[model samples]
Target: MISKNFYYQLITRVLGIVVTAIVMAFFFLKEYNALGIVVAIALIIQTSLLIQFTNNTNRKIAHFFNSIKNEDFTLRFPENLDIKSLRELNSSLNMLNSMIQKVYLKNEAQEKYYQEIIKQANIGILTLNKKGHILFVNPMMENLLNYKPLNHINQLAQVSEELHRFFSNIEPFENKLFQFSNEREKVQLSIKSTSVMLNKEELLLVVAQDIHKELDKNETDSWIRLIKVLTHEIMNTITPITSISASISKFFKVGDSIKPINELTENQIKSTSKGLDVIKEQGENLMDFVQSYRTFLSVPNPDKEPISALKLLDNVRLLLESSNTNITIKTIVKPFDLEIFADEKLINQVLINLIKNAFQALENRDTGGVITLLAGINENHTKYIQVIDNGSGISEEVMSEIFIPFFTTKNKGSGIGLSLSKHIMRLHGGSIIVVSNDIETKFTLLF
Candidate 1:
């Protein structure tokens, strides 16, 4: 196939030959015709210029096609070609280049979007090939495992010996959850695996989540349910016995029926009356104790508000002060104003109970034995109030039961004060922990 430039060169050569043939004929037929010779020479010079122009244009066109072949679209072809045929070719090539560029840009954008979603996902996502080779892991997976995905994907093993055993036991396993613990941290993860077909090959997609908080909440709820069941049973037995005994005592008042029968019956009635009175009193005490339990569980969903530590301590001190001036209650509040979000009423109850216990624990100690109340914050960013006693400290055995319902060391104690106070703290999303030795026992309320 001859190019447009070749056709132009052929046409120029043909014109020059024809003009030369005419000049030669004129020279032979009519000698010394200078004008005809000059015209022939001019046509030869004009053809030479046309040939050079065609050669240059062809070179540029070759370079343009070579650039496109090399995927270099930066080379721009001439749009305004003097030759109509080549001009149409240039327009078609430019349109094709523009279409290819648009497709490349769209593919690049989609690749970037896919990677961005993987990076931003909250669920810990991981991919494992059929050969158990980890192919991909996101940032969430790295964060949950406390190991960077960039470092340990294909090389590191995700399952431990225990988890491996559990997974191997399932036959033709579909999706399954396996609990795993890390050797590096106090973290537990539930890994759920689902096999997916990608590129006509099987791969596993593992989704992991940390369930430590959920487990802790479940255990706490179980304990509360057990305690409620026991309290209900105890109340049921106590209530009926007290009521029956008290009604039986009214039989004694119907006397004078039989003389001898009346005396024996009256004596029996007196004993029953005394027994019934004891039962009734104990039942009422039991009811009050149960009421306290209800109150502990019924910690009004705290209307949490930021409160100053100093003000909270002052309120506790005012509530604890009595007419007797022997006991010295010292408040060692931090100078800086520490604020915490908590229920003021519930916190005040916890502080006051600890204060009263501290004072009571110091009953036999020397006068002015200080019951120190300290308020501060811990490193975990949780605020705390500590009540320290300088009198007779609580024994280890008693400390264990200090927060138990109806367990008290005092002579006339209901034993629900500390228990109720601890529950109140828990309801406010906090806790009360007691640590005691023979020297000093401290009750720290953490909020």
Candidate 2:
């Protein structure tokens, strides 16, 4: 109907123009005809009215587009336009405006959610541009940094160089440690970063978490465990010794004072000697327990150096093979020249520990099992060494306790192997991760 309206409008204008021209021609050429004059006047008036109608419709269309550009969704058109085509165009514009309003509301709601999450997040977070300009510093960041509302990443330079360095050159998917003092309070923060583009501007969305309290809590827990173990061992030794010594004292009789040791029977003497011997044995065991605790507590500082990963694995393989000739060792290094910066001797010890663990996991197999040593760089360019074993994997219950010093599942195990490995990785600014399944147990050292 709208298309037909447009067609009729065009034809009407053309016919009116032709009629007016013919009437003017007759009036001028044939002296004067009243009817021709009247008809020409009428035609002119009709064309003027048509031009005004076209202008009104054009004005309404222009206004509708202007409203859209200005984001004025409230601007509404009346549905009673006389021209069918103009009315249909108005209806379509109104519909489009309604959809835009709905979309705008939805976006507003989503933005609100984002703001709430950012504000309440526990981790210190901020968005920074390539130029190091900071934006959207969350409350956690303010508290963590102890900075008066930061305006730029460089503002952290006022706090400490370590803090400044962290926000300045952060990379995508990077996890880094930053230590610095804010006033008198020293802070150890773990900084992580991700890349994002918001409002067509590239940003580094960084998070900083002050792990000082967490470390303190862990230290407290370790101390508690050590105390518990010490208490248990001491009580086990001292209780028996105390009972035996008391029994020996009963042999002496006080006649005015005390009985002479020379008057004791052979059975009493034998009993006393046996008790002392037992005490001596228990004392020796207690000493061994204390010594193990000392070894566990006094992990040597790492002597870090750049060492080829393959060579490290090979050294570990040679060491393990020399002791246990039955287990097969397979070393695989991707881009075999991959180098890890760590304490060569310490890293070797860690590798030996993990490989030995893998071998032990496979020990009971009827067929000699293979221990796999793998080295590669992850997508984030982190160097990793994995030791894999196809054995009965670790149980969930045992896995959780494996890294605790003196916690173990095997007989004759002192249980510090995994714990010590973890300590070495931390010293070298890396981590150790373990994954166990029915198929295999994998221990990965990430650097």
Candidate 3:
């Protein structure tokens, strides 16, 4: 390539001759013939070379510009050419290529990061352009719609009415939500739709959050209130009969002692006494059952305090340990020394009940299966305490009723342990959720 400095020098030499000719034309007119011939030949050669150089430069410039326009970053300026200006052009082009590559890589990484973040999220996200065509859909959205995103956007409309409502609400800057349900399950989804202006075009972004569990909880609470009403009504009807029976028996006994009648009255008093005793025993049993129900209903407010988690676990272990050789308890504490606010006594009771139930679950086994306690904090900053058991796992049909009062798998149970524990956690502003599979059953306490 020719250097810029060398080209400038050649142009300088040409201008110098032109200046000399103009000077001689004015100063030496009589000796013009021989000098004019030699001067004319020198001018022709310089002009011809200048024209050829200009054409070559123009063609090379055109080719370089064409290569860049074609997006061909791999093309390079020819090496070892005599053109000096081309060297400087090559250097500039190489720097531009490096900058472009760096920008491309940076943008690629940003896109990948955005995709990973969206993929990990539980919420479903979908985006659409102004023409109502789906521009982008994350994996969560794909799974939610039950269709491949690469498929036509129209296919989504066939599966979900909530999706249709979401798309319709995107226009006019309005927010909307819809409910979707099948025979087996129901879902309440809170949906938000908004138009985003980018490069003079409007796009839509839709975000959906699942609120099905909240709906189901509300339904459960309604059922619990109904049960409370029925229990209260039954108690009201039984208390008067129980009081009347006791008073009549007392009167009969007093009359028997007076000896107003004969042997028949004595026999009647004996029979009445036995009947009274039986009535009292039955009444007391019913009241005891009612008292258990009352305790479950009157859930106490939590006086939350910060306590060492390991200490609470130790307390639970000490409280539940028995002399039975078949029962074994193992506890493993994580290295985290984090503090949390909760009702320690209530939490201890919850653990004790869970451990007791786990031990009971292994009745048929030669030796009780291991029951594991695990504690950890989730990425959402929620504290999770889990009781995992390897005993006979609960079947799916009965799993749903485990939290309901008087629903028990054991024959002699009051059926209020899990129910009471669930209420206590609710009072403490937490939750107890159970997940059971074929091999294991787990109760997760989330705070």
Candidate 4:
């Protein structure tokens, strides 16, 4: 509410100016004398000065609001106004401007703080609109991709189509595992997507961390475990034979007394024969274990070549045709021309091993038993050859150890098949994963 004095002052000034101007005009027209004209000029001058003086506070207030709008908050409010209401308005505006300035400074500081964190993070970060236009990209993103000035998600298509597909189909909270191949090497990236809304614009925020080193660490750990397992098994197989040989030697020496070379009893001969047989069996088992280890480590560097997926699938089908297993085998090649760059022989070996495993699973089934080799690109446009079996699937208990070397469930299983396959894929800068349930099982080789 305006103060009574403030309202009356405005009314009084306007009425005074109008009345004096009207009287000056009347005197000028009624008497054209020198005194009358002089009086009229004096009144006019007084009115102009009064108008300017009365509006002096309003002009200053307008300039104050203009300064606040422009964020130029250095304008000082008048402190010496004779009018009490004008002084109060000026004081309130000054205080309000000061508070707004503090709030603006605080907000600016917060934005800078977050920006610094995002810039220094090790993971690549991206904020994009619904059209895939990059709204903001952190420095880590440029480092990870080695693509400077990234403006749109479609730019990834020039680097890798798989990467393009990945971002386009990414959903909130989705975790995606993919590899980006550069000229020098391939980097394994694990990305997670989150949805955020800023200023009413929907955006997808993605965080990608390079996991190549992590994978190497995990692989090194697996190798260590395998070595330990090998050591344990070797000691276990040899320990029994060592004890038996020592006991047999005691029998030959007649209970610690040196006997003649030919003075052995009939029971001693039998015992010796039994012990020899056990020793030979254990020796052969150890030999077999060593041979398996040799085979496991004998994987030659893949002779890299552009191998047609269809041709590889046909070769596998022919190889499996020689087996008498009644389980049906089918081949599916999406786009028919789908191909991969890998060692043809190694990939064939992996595929054949997977098909053999499927056949074993289908052994007792009479109907609805089939193994399908599906070759296609995943949604991320990465090449994949998946072996799916509709027979009794792998149990969860057994699934976990399927890829561990020398761990097997089948009677004649050597247990290194899956492990070898995994190593081969890793050599090709890819991986293999097994997904199984009660109804179906899948082994996917991703490249």
Q: After best superposition, candidate 1 residue 239: deviation in angstroms?
A: 11
TM-score of the candidate numbered 3? 0.49
| Model number with the top TM-score | 2
Reference-based lDDT, residue 309, model 2? 84
Which residue window of length 10 is worst by lDDT in model 3? 255-264
lDDT string, candidate 3, 1-447, tens digits: 335664785677579668756755744576776776676666677767767766766776677667666656676665455655656656666666667767767987999999899888998787777566777777877665556753345575676765555555456455556676633455567777777876788878777766676677878885985486447545654675577677655644665574345534566667667767767766776777778789888867888999777777767776766644576666656646755589887888889889888888765677757777777788888887888888779998788678877567675666789988998888888899998887878998888
Superpose all Cα atoms of candidate 3 onto the true structure and report the RMSD in Å to 1 decimal. 13.8
What does the lDDT read for residue 413 in candidate 2?
55
What TM-score goes with each of the models? 0.47, 0.75, 0.49, 0.55
Which digits, one per residue and each the tens of the lDDT, describe model 2 over residues 117-150? Answer: 9889988898888888887789999889888688
Once fitted onto the true fold, the runs of candidate 2 whose alpha carbons sit more than 4 angstroms away are: 1-62, 65-71, 127-135, 145-197, 200-206, 229-274, 296-308, 318-328, 339-343, 363-370, 395-400
Local distance difference test values of all predictions, in order: 0.71, 0.83, 0.72, 0.83
C-alpha lDDT (0 to 100) for residue 53 of candidate 4: 58
* Model 4: CA > 4 A from native: 1-224
> Which whole-number lDDT from 0 to 100 does residue 356 have in model 4?
87
Write model 1 residue lDDT over 222-247, tens digit each, in one string.
57855764575577558768677756
